[model samples]
Target: MSQKKMLRFSTGALLLLLPWFGGLVLGEISNDFSQCLDFFYNTTPPVGITAAGYQPICQRYKNQYHFASLYNRQSRSPLYSAYVLSPADGKRPRSTWMFEPQLAFSRASSEMQRFQTPLDQNVIESQAVLEDYKNSNFTKGHLNPSQHQKTVEDRKATFTLTNIVPQKAGSNSGPWNGLESEVLNRFKAFCNGSMHVITGAMPYESEPRWINNRVSVPEYMWSAYCCPSYRSDLPEFLKPFFPTYAAVGRNDRNSGEEIVPVNAKAGASVRGYDVRRMSLEALEGILKQRLGMPITLFHGQCQ
Candidate 1:
């Protein structure tokens, strides 16, 4: 039978044996991907080497860099995830950013060697491609952080233009940042299992430029991360807020139109993409086919 037929048959059979097979499938796919940490990390061949047009949602780029995402919506914005991540260093032997992962992860693998940082300002700016803005009040923001790199050199490399967005200071450093940290902390406390987080900022019409880059990139940028395993500790006070951890801007200066607050009981959605109900395999399939690359997992351990 064809792959499609085979997949269908297997899925049906699994459904009978495993009622939660759907959840398992989704988990497997999601676990296969890593968050979109950098524009140039462990990307597959030509996709890594080529610069393609910008995609609004988490789309695929050159098959290698698949935008595995939790949500996609017309009203909200697009989000992206990475297919692979490795060391990224230009030809310069003096550069330490390329190998910074070594310091961040206690156990670094040789494959991480392929990861390189966006060294040239011109090149970094080109990849980020900041665009026009709609509401001056809103700023482009990064969902994935370069700061995840702990080492001084690795952290600095994340400052590359490719990993930036035009975001309001209040959102960037204030409530938005707090929300990310809170969610991460809560995830560790609750699930006792790893969770993947993909986030993106919705773009308006006008695109703004960052300081000193001499170029403009997306008005809003998205960042995503995954922790397939979580800690088992529990806290009663924190349980109420745990479910909505992935939601953005729980606390912010009310623009009246920009931020959306989510309720854990009712749940929330981004654009049309259901933030709570997306499978990584489905996400990967879409990205891989869209970018025209073979099946290459981007996020999590595979990254």
Candidate 2:
């Protein structure tokens, strides 16, 4: 939370750009998330959000569909990425950042492609490129983090840039990461079936922040999950998180302490990047206030 400029650090090793799954790629974005409907509960996307420049992406990679991202064409960041919670299978994949090629050129390959040298003028103009995060003092935070996935391919597919946001090192590696780990444990413990999760970024209402004046830096990060089929025998404290639960974490340590209060006792590295857990209804209410839309994360409130 210091006023001084955030120190620069290596985000990751930009290893060789990997190959895309040549066979099963979903062509350019469409009007809806129909291609990746399996990722959503009841096969429905969030309701009440306006339809504008937001593009629906069926994130395809390595011959498989991993998740769905609702990308903002203008801000060059994803509003949300929806996917089914699955158990971790292996170590995190190498950080070979990729891009949804079809987002830039419709006739281009349907699969997400690894960034090449010099970059394409159309690709840079259409979406976020690796250059945006280089020395930008921010990390490429995954909205649909790879840790909450089932297979190696599923985890690697999350490396696509369309599903990332500009997040501070404190937030991305601090409380926000803890929350993701906790959710994965919860899924392993109680959920008997699919746990549909939607993780997203919330922009500041009054002022928006950006990295390299391109990708938007979220003021807060939010997530919600729907697990209709859960163990019937649940402890009292665990009941609330059975069918649904949600949380909002601070991406900016300097942000106000209203939505997520800072843990003064915590280490300085993660001091202000606190996370607040709440009910699905509470999260929806907050989303409505900040987004200026009546947001419903799941159908029938995931009943």
Best by TM-score: 2
lDDT of 2 by residue, 31-146 (tens): 88877799999999999988588888888886667899999999999999999989878899899899877877765667887888768688899999998999999999999999
Residue-level lDDT of model 1, residues 148-179, one tens digit each, is 32233433443322333456665566555655
Q: Which ranges of candidate 1 are over 4 A from the true structure?
A: 1-52, 55-125, 128-141, 187-195, 205-228, 236-244, 250-255, 258-303
- Global fold similarity of model 1 (TM-score): 0.38
lDDT of 1 at 232: 37
* CA lDDT for candidate 1: 0.35
For candidate 1, give the lDDT of residue 164.
38
Lowest summed-lDDT stretch of 10 residues in model 2? 9-18
Query: Considering summed lDDT, which 10 consecutive residues are worst modelled in model 1?
Result: 22-31
